[model samples]
Target chain A: METARISTWQFFILALGYLLGTSFFFRIGGLISIAKQDAWMIPLWSGIAGVLLVLIWIKLANYYPGNTIIQICIQVAGKGFGGFIALLYIGYFVHLSALITRNLGDFMKINLMPRTPIVVFHVMFLLVICYAVTKGVETISRSTEFLFPLVTVTFLLIFFIALSEWNWDRFQGMFHMNIWTTMKETRSLIGFPFMEAFVLMMLFPYVKSKNRIKVSFILANVVTALLLSLGVFFTIGVLGVTRASHETYSLFVIVQEMHIGTFFEHLESTIALILLIVIFIKLSISYYCAVSGLCQLFQVNNRSWLSISLILLVSGLSLGFDNILENIVFNREYYFEYMLLFAVIFPLLFLFLTWMKKGKEKRKVVGSQA
Target chain B: MIWFILFIAVALATSIFMMVKQKKSTKEIMLFSTIVLLGFADWISIFLERKFNPNHWIASFIDWISL
Candidate 1:
């Protein structure tokens, strides 16, 4: 078991940063395209469901106090099956790291560095992430204490400036979609941004205050969902649904629209920098989880080799996607379902097994006492 | 491609320098060396632009299942 412990505040900020991650930059358009004006509601509703999922995760975490989800799997499902599940999770975390890295590279290529090869950005960022992960979770979480405030203040600045461009008409037809369609659109939110918090289960054992874990996790989700919803709401109000849906980076587009008598005509780059910082924190956390999870699974005491290897692997794999469009399409069509199974369905099943095992142990104790 | 190679070299050198300074074990060194070798193999494949791409493979697997 890893002995590193982070403060509850650090864990809270880490969760918030991870939840915001690439979603801040890339996910809004998908939501707007699906829900139109009602896209903001997706996060609010999904956040409630996210809280339930977090509760289940917390229960499982408390049940296996010092063990990660990987170890929990081994304990709950037995050796062979649990190891298979753990391996699958390892793949999931690594894949998630790659996808987020690609997202960052793609965002930079499109908005900021159109001339530079995307691979360069991937390599550079992964180098930093590789270094951070080697320093362990505490270091990453401490860095977020600075980054989270910077991102929040910058995001708020963009939010307030974009208000000048908001149009009430854009919010028309809010409930035009049927219930089922609305719910379907929300799966993208729930599965991708929200359930991605499931990765935090790996870090739960590292949090100092186990008793406060559930509250911090849920609070972090609420704040992230509110921020995301506000971002989407502002995008639709400023750009309208049609324009917002068509644009890849709706927040970037909105920030580009900010104009204060020609003085602040070009703030998109500044805003993009803020988004990049938040996404970096997000990617670093996921990268750490992936590398450390592998270390735990392999029972490797020295994580330096494994961390560098996985970082290289992820950075290289991120270049596999032909372009950002293919990645977006894949996320919309398939990635959520994949994440949902592992993040939500599998955890619930694990919880059920845990309950059953506990019941059996209780019965065994009672029979012994008798 | 040259920049890619340079970046990888710098990253590996820095990582090794840190590990050695921190006195990481021999097993750790061996493992890190193996990963660096694997990274070089990947770089060669990427330079060659081979059709057997892991990225496409994973994407295709997800695509196939989602379909």
Candidate 2:
């Protein structure tokens, strides 16, 4: 299979889109509920932690220039154990993609079309994602680059407009510290939007500018952190922590409250449009990763068949969730830890083994030269 | 139920079309068939009065082991 190469800028856009995707819609309420008025600080701290994980991924990518995480695992752990680990990672990606699909389906069912069956949303969305994946990563990355700027600008516009309704007193309790609570909230943040950046490692081999991978990673993280922190800040300021925490989709509520001199009222549709774009990019990337991982795992030369099949599988799986509330609870409670295990703990272990192996090979080379 | 059937039909049609166009290997065709069949089985499980939720099962397993 010929690897599709994407420019660093496109790669950065894809990362930013992935980070802002569902997290922009769903994370604020949980963050506010946990951190209260100080929720705004969580993204900044979590973004720093995310960068450390990115550094680990970059180190591993530098070690093996053209290999995906699955290949890297096979090289590090030997074929049998490494293949098992690779399957686990593939499972994690597929599961994560299904949840994101379900989340988007549920969001639309609840907000945009209450009368429509959730499966309709899931199937239609998955069809689009399947098409995008079959076209390859360069197509997805290029589309993300074109859409990223528009989404960012619209998101910031909504943020600043919501600032009109901001009450300065919401920051009153900002300085009041709750060390344990903040730390607990930070764990979920890191487990989610931050640590989830590790999925981008699968795309590292596809990045055209190898040396600028780190720069693109850092830039994407910083921009995402700023955007998310400001989102929390605006949500708390406009709605207050109590209201923000109580609302399921706080950003939607915030956008609804934007009046724009009474002429441009009820911009929830515009907000919904933005949400759809970001979520589409995020889901497409996840679908691509999962399908591509399966191709690599199963040694399938043609991915179109598997891509369509997996799309159906994911759409079907998304319907398996009992309800939106259950989905939310599962994500906040279980999904984070599940992702952390695969994205962090396992990768770190593999990186250590790879390092030891490199050292041994280096010593052998030195001895041979002597 | 009708929607489920329609979705499955479309999926099957696409799989067949792709297999013919690309001349997919036997392994690829078999994998596609298995996935499509599994998806259909899962969809029908709802009507069979079975509470089949792989998502919840996995989540419960994770929660159990973590505990």
Candidate 2 local lDDT, A1-370, one digit each (tens): 4378999989888998898778989999988888888888889988888888888888888888888898888888988999999888877777778888888888898899999988888889889999999999989988888887888788778867777787989878786768776776458677778778888888988888899989999888888888899888888888998999999999998888778776999899998888888888998888888888877877787677788888767876777778988877776776667777877788889889988998999999999999
DockQ of 1: 0.33
Among these predictions, the greatest DockQ belongs to: 2
| Model 1 CA lDDT for position A242 | 94
Tens-digit lDDT track of model 1 for A1-370: 5678899999999988888767877888889898888888888888898898898888888888988888888888987998889988987887888888888888888889899999899888888888888888878888899877988788778778778887899898887877687787567778778888999998988988889988899999998888889888888889999998999988888888788996778988898788778877888888887777767766778666787677667776777667877877677766667776788778888989988988999999999999
Each candidate structure's count of clashing pairs: 0, 0
User: Ten consecutive residues with minimal summed lDDT in candidate 1 chain A?
Assistant: A295-304
Q: Is the docking of candidate 1 incorrect, acceptable, medium or high quality?
A: acceptable
Q: Candidate 1: where is the Cα deviation over 4 Å?
A: B1-45, B48-67
Candidate 2 residue A289 C-alpha distance from true site, Å = 0.4
Question: In order, what DockQ does each candidate have?
Answer: 0.33, 0.58
Chain A TM-score, structure 1:
0.96
- The lDDT of model 1 is 0.82
